[model samples]
Target: MHKKILLAYDGTEEGRVALLECADIAHLLRAETHLLAVMRVPSGVFLAEGFVPDTVMEDERQRIRETIDDGVALLREGGYSAYGHLACGEPVEEICRLAAELGVDLIVLGHRKQTSFASRWWKGSVGISLLERAPCSILVAVGT
Candidate 1:
């Protein structure tokens, strides 16, 4: 029943695992797959006292673009119909917006386990936020 699946890939180890799982599910369902890499703008860029060079921002964007391209290639090599997308914004917001825009049936994410309670509390959880705000179903693949 899942005709359109969106995979959020960040080129991390966890993300690669999620990509494999998403590819398998997509193939099983004969669904079209889309790989998304969200490029988070550095907080320094927004702070009045902080100075971020244009070159640094460009380099980061290029890296994210390469990651998305690599993820799409991996999916295609695995025999799934797939394409790559790049979004610039907060990860949760970009993911939700893209899912809604594409009218996707499901969104898959790779979740890295927090090692400490403090870290979890400080950074919050993207998976949790997605569960609450995503426009479609979400499948989170936690790294072992």
Candidate 2:
């Protein structure tokens, strides 16, 4: 039984499904669900491009908030207790760090769109990396 669970959401097709799965598991275990969305922010790249505009960061924050609000609404509609959190930085690293900080019992991750041999052979899966590094149990919800 999980008392606390972290759901990593990328807002992709499969990620949405994983959110639902996380909510389901949360409901069953009576666990508190944390929905985490990590925004990919370019660190050195922005500074290299001279000065960063204020609107850029503001726009990103607004988008992140909207995503979290919508996700929270969906979970509540499904009768699941959920909370949303948005972080900026590398996705996998932030996810792992958050899991550790929050002390969650499990980390629920989403599998990206499936690809054929050629695609899979070219682009590696981040899910595998997260599963390998996460200290807690990982449940990968596959398929979009």
Candidate 3:
């Protein structure tokens, strides 16, 4: 029943798994697919410097752009055309904002299993946060 789907892709192995799964699901549902790549801005960017260097920002953007392009290509290879979006900021915030804007029926994400509680605590869990804040149903493709 999903008419539109948003996939949060980060070019990780987990992301590739999600992309493949999403491609199948999208094809089955005849859904519009959107691939989102988020560039995480470091907290230090808001500190004394008040901003990241233009060159550094550009580099980050370019990297994210490439990641999005790669995702699009993968989807195309799978026989599904997808629109790619690049967002700069926190993952959950950007994902929620775009899901709301796109009115997507489902949001797909890739997650790597963390064996240690400390690791999860230090890094925080975007998937957990998204479960609370996301505007649509979420499907997480877990990877080893």
Candidate 4:
């Protein structure tokens, strides 16, 4: 029953698995797909480093854009009707916000297996956070 699927892609191995899964599901349901790559703002960079250069930020933005473009291309090559978006902000916030704005039926994201409690505590879990805040159903593709 899913008509629109949003894939949160970051070009990681897990992300690639998520992308493939998203594409397969979209194809089976004949749904439209949108790939979103969030460019997280370096909020703490200035505070930690004393100063942040504009060019460095710009380079990061460019890389995120390229990643989004590559995701869209791969989806297209797989014969899925898909598009890409680049957003700036927190990853969880941006993903949920875009999913709401697009009125998507499902959000697909990859999950990295965090083995240690310390790692989870330190990095937090974006997938878990999205599950809490997302307006639609979420499918987390856990990497083996």
Spell out the clash pairs found in candidate 4: none
Q: What is the TM-score of each candidate against the true structure?
A: 0.93, 0.84, 0.93, 0.93
* lDDT (CA) per prediction: 0.91, 0.83, 0.91, 0.92
Ranking by lDDT: 4, 3, 1, 2
| lDDT-superior candidate, 1 or 2 | 1
Q: 1-144 in candidate 4: lDDT tens per residue?
A: 999999999999999999989988998999999999988767576755676778888999899889889999998988889999998888999999999999999999998998899999999999889979999999999777
Candidate 2 ranges with C-alpha deviation above 4 Å:
42-51, 114-124
lDDT of 3 by residue, 1-144 (tens): 899999999888999999888998999998889999998877776657587788888998998899999899878787786899999889999999999999999999999888899999999999999999999999999765
lDDT per residue (tens digit) for residues 89-134 in model 1: 8989999999999999999999898899999999999999899999
CA displacement after TM-score superposition, residue 50 of candidate 4 (Å): 7.1
C-alpha-based local distance difference test score of model 2: 0.83
Model 4 residue 66 lDDT score: 90
Q: Model 2 — which ten-residue stretch has the worst lDDT?
A: 40-49
- What TM-score does candidate 4 reach? 0.93
lDDT of 1: 0.91
